[model samples]
Target chain A: MKMPGFDISLVIIWALVAVLVVLAWRRGEGRLQRGLRRGFEMFLINGPRVVVALLAAGFLSYFLPKALIAEWLGHESGWQGILIGSAVGPFFPGGPLVIFPVLVALLKAGAGLPSVFAFLTSASVWGVHRIIMFEIPMMGPRFAAARMIASLALPPLSGLMAVLVIRLLGAPAGVIP
Target chain B: MNALKRKKASLLSEIFGVPFWVFAAISLVMGVLTWQLRGPATVEAAVMGDIDLFLFLVPRMLGGMLIAGLVQVVLPPEVVAKWVGAESGFRGLLIATVVGALTPGGPMTSFPIVVAFYMSGADRGALVAYITAWSLIGFQRFMIWELPLLGPEVALYRVLSVFWMPVLAGFIARRLTIWTAPPPSEEGTR
Candidate 1:
């Protein structure tokens, strides 16, 4: 999915940054100067997350068959569909950046609202990517496993819970997966 | 050069370095432990699912670091601050939320700013909401990549789904008493 027109925001952000850097450079306030340095450091720190999203974007595009997967989940069915949606949600690494769009498409393709919502929330909250990248590194496999068990269950719980809430609040303009 | 090397070496000293490498040992132990202690399918799924995802996700995550660097160099802090630092009510939360959606750098992007916000007396719930909103919504991504693949209806729904999430998150913050995220351990905790 390429929208050259929308790509302008990133380029625009850069241009704006350039202007701000110059303006701050001229003003030369001590606080702003320090902030500029910290800003640079932050860029260094966050640089990789961007790459991860892009790659996840690619992974989702290449590996997953969207409509088929949505159908397999039986998204239009009632409680069972929500169960299926939530169950499949966490394992798929694609974030809402991909999931929601896919969810909307799934809806058009015949998936139901609650199922889509369940999938979106589950995917967002309990993604598999971080289990691999984060859990293994910081906590090691044992703790990671514990967390995963707990986390995996939560996605469905969130969906089911959403039902309890949405049933009460009435899914104002669509709840997420 | 020697002094710089010493600094770098100390930073990567045994205490920090050993644990990182020893993750393999831990993973091995955990695998065996789970294999012995847990059921067959549990161990099998754990081995297949998490490790595969870890393998696939880490390199790209590392790559995401460079994009974050480029974004910072490109967008600077003040612009980020202006865009993200609106008031804490619904509108303010909305601005922060959408900005977070559009901008998709990891913790490294706003964690520092979040620290600053914390130091400057940001509300606890609002900060939580801000971070959540940012990670959940990738506005730039939706516009650039999603619209084309899924078409406008899906894309528009995508936008709308996220549109109120941040605000919802902020309001929900008041209700979620369990988010003991250590009260923004930094100044400017946006």
Candidate 2:
């Protein structure tokens, strides 16, 4: 697969850095060096954890129970499916590449909108691997813990809200998987 | 001289910390499992793919780090504190919600900013709101991924229904932080 080494995202990031550098320069030339040094220190401190986390995520991606999720969510709807979706979200790892396709599969297989929305919400918010690999390492345990607990009810709540939405406006048409 | 050398060694090791070791152990086990269950070829492919991703992320993350570091130096702490500090209240959460939703890119891009803001006197509530907003309602992801894949109707409703999540989460986090032990501003290894 082709890697996006120099994508629009990277360009935007570099642009931000350029602007920040200019800001630092106006503050003082010493601030520029100081900022760069601090950034380098950050890299040294956190880079290894990032590398390990990536490796772990990559290896684990191979084992995601895609078929199992389809089985669990393919036929169910309503609160049960929503509950299942919330439970299953964290286990489905990887980024959009892994997630959206699974969602497409579930929807195509006749999963309900509320369940899928719940799945997406929890997958993004309570991502187990993300917490283990990035959040805990980068942001610390308290922040991670607090964030997790704070957002714990969101998936089901959103799922319930989606039910309300569908009742009022109707479900969107299924994807073309 | 010996003590200095020990301190340097400890710092080097400390940087890796428990998370690194735990992940290293998990990766090792997974590597063994992949080789056994799939094949050596699969293991090789996984490593190469991960390396490519790592390389792709390095530039962006470094840029994020640089911006974060520079912001800490250039932006006044009082400004950050007044805007997003514990005392910043609901309005602080609102600002965080908007900023977080607007922030583009992945965790590598966002987390560094979170660190910088935390160091610069932002409160836990605002920080949590920022992250929640970025995850749940980020415009970039919604436009690029959701609209294209799920179509506009579903995407619109999904967003509309859950738009207030960040502020709610932030509110909860604010109280939770106060109720619990205080989180330090420094980069935590735990």
Candidate 3:
């Protein structure tokens, strides 16, 4: 489970950051300083939340037994598994760093594409924590509510798509145990 | 000056929001649970693992924040408004989708940008598209998180499946607003 790409991506990211920093500097007096200052401010603001969230995710990975997850979300579980995945997604309560590893764990534990797809889609679209924290406060409740209502069908739709893709491509057959 | 004041207020609220408290509480509870279930050694191990992850994440997160800040400073509001504003129509929605997909950072960074666009006269449909696109298939998230974790095949398939969603959601949102608007006569009377 070594991610060879991780190092390469990190290099690319730092390179981009350097370019942006130089560009900001060239933009004229005070602009680069202001941008860096703002960036640092954001880093500080988000630091605590990120730490706790990752800690929680670490605890979750330890707590959720691999065998139980495999039994509940495995390929043979069918649509029921997808439904459960969708239901659990919005309540998972973390960002990509937490969620993706958990998903990987589930996949390793034998969850199929449909369940995984449903879970990811639901979490991304309707994560309750995000809705309450970011969406309602930033976008206003009406906008958030409207978007939520309109996108309500996405999780199941994505799940169905996953099922079709699996059938067409014979995925989850050789991909997972 | 008024806008600056408003921005300060919002920033204050954001710092004190439920997200911080909720996440803290969750972490504490989970830590306790892990201690109970796996004993103190496992809990310590988990904390150490988190510290390792934190070291990896901090640089990337700071870089992301820097990029986001630079973009905000570089891209003129007028340009953003012209591309994704009320006057831009369906093209605005499309542009919004692309911008949202390309934008770096998570919701904490993005939602504020979306609000800035709203203040700059961006269309509701475009805003919807922007948020939807970011949530569903932001390129940064896919490249950094999904591709590495899920592998290329699953990531590609997931992206392909949800590719049209943001555009469709935006269109539907636009139509809903239109349908729910007051009649022209009623508006004149009011």
Top DockQ prediction, candidate number: 3
lDDT of 2 by residue, B1-190 (tens): 9998997797788788886788789889989999999999999998998787567666756776676567657765444444554445788889888878866557877787788777666778888888899888876566445654455577888987799999999999888865565656532111
Chain B superposition TM-score per model? 0.49, 0.53, 0.61
Backbone clash pairs for candidate 3 read none
lDDT of 2 at B1: 100
lDDT of 1 by residue, B117-180 (tens): 5455555445545655555555434433443334444444444444455555565553443433
Q: How do all the candidates rank in terms of DockQ, highest first?
A: 3, 2, 1
Provide the DockQ value for model 3: 0.46
At residue B62, candidate 2 shows an lDDT of 70
Q: Is candidate 1 or candidate 3 better by TM-score?
A: 3
Q: TM-score, chain A, per candidate?
A: 0.51, 0.57, 0.67
Interface residue Cα RMSD of candidate 3 after superposition? 4.5
- Candidate 3 docking: what grade? acceptable
Structure candidate 2, residue pairs in collision: none
Candidates 1 and 2: which is better by TM-score? 2
CA RMSD, predictions in order? 11.9, 8.8, 5.9
